[model samples]
Target: MATTRKQHSEQSAPGPVAAFARFVGCGGGVGVASSFAVAGLASWIPWALANALVTAVSTLLATELHARFTFGAGRHATWRQHVQSAGSAAAAYAVTCLAMVVLQQLVATPGAVLEQVVYLSASALTGIARFAVLRLVVFARSRTQATAPAPAVRPVRAAAPAGPAELCPAA
Candidate 1:
């Protein structure tokens, strides 16, 4: 059987916090699922490299998903948005890498679960930053003249004539 996606109106769009939560949930699912697949090979390659690879792939998928679902930019996805996504992904990866370093120092042999915990904590922290960048920078509403409202017209009042001198003379 075939399935369909729900249509969302711009005015009725989800709030920023709601959208961010959804985006993270969707993106986190992709990240965790793929990370599990990569975790199996920890012995073969360095844990950090494995985590980095997972982060790259997961981020690519997450950004695409966010563009479609969260920002409502499905067909209108722009190169600028994609670049911002890449930047967010890079930040997430860097944070995870740093966490990996700290984990490595703390334990001689970190298990997959332990590494996953660290990666997730770092990702959660970075997700807030990503949401800010994406909302305020990438998909921000433009203050273009076209969308701006026309200025209101005010009626000009005529100035009072020099009647003060005329009144004094009449008195």
Candidate 2:
């Protein structure tokens, strides 16, 4: 049986709502893991290195979740695709962290509590940015496939007779 254009398009496209939900669920899991890691290991490692390590690991987990759930099982994304998507997210995360750092510096707080507050705010921003990028880019269908017009079908016409038919005389 032949597939209709609508069926093909629907099969190829991922739903935005489902993708967003998967992103949030995966991000929450990653966040919990990262927080645990940071809380347990921050004293042992430099802050920057610890953050980088946690982000890298969390990104891997998030990418796998995105591929499996957001993009669906049959659609396997290349490493480069994963990197490009995750890199955009990471860049956003870095910017958020930098902004928090700058803010903390300007505020000039004396206690460790201020530093913790900045970290939490930055973490939340990073997760939000990561989810947005994943939904908009990583799991989004290719533009060529998504927007391409379906092939047109023409109506079939009966073939003309090779010779003229004899006309019947009126009674």
Candidate 3:
């Protein structure tokens, strides 16, 4: 009964498209803010390491946002969700890093503007993918339970007697 009620609540939360919009809004805000931090840190350290640090912090923040606002989980993310989301974030980190590496290979001296453009572009691409994975994988359990039908309740039929109810009549 409790599970059914919980599932019913989750069923009323945002569907995929709405959740995607929320995901982009919340997660993108965090990503953009972290990018600035990453840029600053990169000036002081290696770009890859800076991005990695920012990615970890931003992943935790975004996971909480995704749990509370994006998917309407209405609570803080569990450690499991955080870890799963971190996996997605790691992939996103690899994307942005690879994009930067490619840009460096292509341009002998990319300006700050070019770097930001490439970085944000790669982030946007990966954001879409991250949304899908988060929606269908990380945050999918509630939605799945919500949408799934309740188990059928069939009446228990009484077994018929083997031929002669006359010989074995009920007392």
Candidate 4:
């Protein structure tokens, strides 16, 4: 049987606040890992370049995490959703790269510490934006599930009691 949009919405996992919190947690973990990767690569590559590479990798990682943990995409994920996810990732990478470039110029030459600070700051902002896009656009199906009304429960009727005269006559 086909389910109504409202019924589907009620079945979606993770309330908005819960989803956002999960996204933040996942993004935070990705940020930490990305920052470390960037720091490790900074000595070998240009700071901005290192950040860009790490940010790109991290964004991809985040997409999967957000899909699974934040939005419950599971097997329902579609190519369209993948495209939206990629778009969000690109936006995040762009913001991170731009922030690193600006930070590098502001400071004569930033060390790993300063670069990490800037990178994390950029990641924080990108996380918020990514959450919005992933929820409202990438996972639009989930949003429907989130907002749909709960299914109406049918109450069961009780069986009628036997009359006292019928019970006595049966004996």
- Higher-lDDT candidate of 2 and 4: 4
lDDT of 4 by residue, 1-171 (tens): 998754543466677899889888888888898889888897799866887787667766777777666775443445677678878777887888889778868999777778778878988898888888888888877557555766899999997898988778854
Supply candidate 1's per-residue lDDT for 31.
Answer: 69
Residue 85, model 4: lDDT of 81
Minimum summed lDDT over a 10-residue window in model 2 is located at 139-148
Q: Kindly report which residue stretches of model 3 are placed more than 4 angstroms away from their true locations once superposed.
A: 1-11, 146-171
Q: Write down the lDDT of every candidate, Cα atoms only.
A: 0.70, 0.64, 0.88, 0.76
lDDT of 1 by residue, 52-103 (tens): 7777677667776776667654444467767777888888888878888899
Off by over 4 Å in 1: 1-11, 41-43, 142-171
Model 4, TM vs. native: 0.70
Taking all chains together, each candidate's TM-score versus the true structure is: 0.70, 0.63, 0.81, 0.70
Which candidate achieves the best TM-score against the true structure?
3
Which runs of model 2 end up more than 4 angstroms from their true locations?
1-14, 73-76, 103-117, 142-171
Ranking by lDDT: 3, 4, 1, 2
lDDT of 3 by residue, 3-108 (tens): 5644445556687888989988999899889889999999999999999999999999999999877886766788888999999999999999999999999999
Give the Å shift of residue 101 in candidate 3: 0.4
Question: Candidate 4: which stretches are off by over 4 Å?
Answer: 1-10, 143-171
Pairs that collide in candidate 1 are none
